[model samples]
Target: MLSLLATLWLAAAPTKDAEPPVPRPPPPECLSSQGRTVCGYQCRSTGTHADCARTPYGVCQVLTGRVHCWDPPRVVIHHPPRSSARPECKESRGNVACGYNCRLSQGEVACNSTPYGVCSTHFGRLVCWDPPESVIHQYGARTPQPRCLNASEAVACGYDCKAQRAEVQCASTPDGVCRLDNQRFTCFDPPSLLHCDHSAPPPAD
Candidate 1:
């Protein structure tokens, strides 16, 4: 009877309590609309609360709580300046000439045309001439005067001629040989006697 009483007391004792189960989070949802698909949403705080949606190409931002998707901004390109449009020019003799054209301004003469000859300024004036005319135009006043010696037997002139008593002659052909023939002093050539006397005759007899 005492053993039976002990068994009843053991059965009456309370059992231990079971622990509670842990809570689980939900899976991410992939939403699809029209032809585009968005995976998840992102939040941005710039002094104000805004939300962004992630897409395959770019992102969609919410302005004033309004959602809008957009592509990246376009890139801009710039080009440098060109140098072939204008030509080089120069100024001279109070004249302005460029390329093949020349003009005068304010009492100044400019020449660029060279179809006849080379363009140049002479005595403050623009002139174009051939080889002979250019030489005369350039050194006409600077050239030395020629003196001729005349006598009964012979006559001589130019830098190479020498006068001795009654006869005057030139030593070398290059010195311009002048001979008094038939009362006329005929020079072979003034500077050089290698060529024929094609030059104009002297003024004095």
Candidate 2:
């Protein structure tokens, strides 16, 4: 029967399996800086913190501040600002401070370092949160005003904290505002600067 109908037409011929695709991951990996602009995939930035994780439980997220991680868990790599550490400056006019015990009155300027680098300031700007232990904070969106910059242990001698990425939202209690850790945003207290809306998608309410 013509070789039994050519073995049933090669077993009813309908086999097309030679698959070898499914590999296209090489885009996202951006890193702007202070102002903000973040992509994804194994990225890295340290103006304060920006890591796009590449494994090791990767999965980071910082909306307003701008940062996008993927897959697994988290990532944080921020160095610098450790020359034995200790900066407690005050007196502002747009001086801007970091860490230590920096504080300016009326105009606002708070300080703190590590143990959750909590800093604060209001009306004029300046905000920070649980940075330093997997840093984050320095968020953007409406983040402007950053003329005089100094660092050491968290301080806003002048301004430009704007919640950044640390995300404390005050309430840790210096008065616990920003909550937990070391707490210290002196200058008469009240007004830790953490309103809302800066950028990305989750800055609405």
User: How close is every model to the real structure, measured as TM-score?
Assistant: 0.18, 0.21
Compose the digit string of candidate 1's lDDT tens values, residues 38-124: 454332333333333332222344333334433211110011012111111345443334322233444654432221123334344
Given candidate 2, what's the lDDT at residue 126?
62
Which tens-of-lDDT digit does each residue in 95-184 have in candidate 2?
A: 444334445667666555432244455444665443322112333211222223233433332223223233322222232223233543
Worst 10 residues of 2 by lDDT: 72-81
lDDT of 2: 0.40
Candidate 1 clash pair list: none
Question: Which residue runs of candidate 1 sit more than 4 Å off their true CA positions?
Answer: 34-61, 64-205
What lDDT does candidate 1 reach at residue 175?
A: 34
Report how far off residue 92 is in candidate 1 (Å). Answer: 68
lDDT scores of the candidates, listed in order: 0.35, 0.40
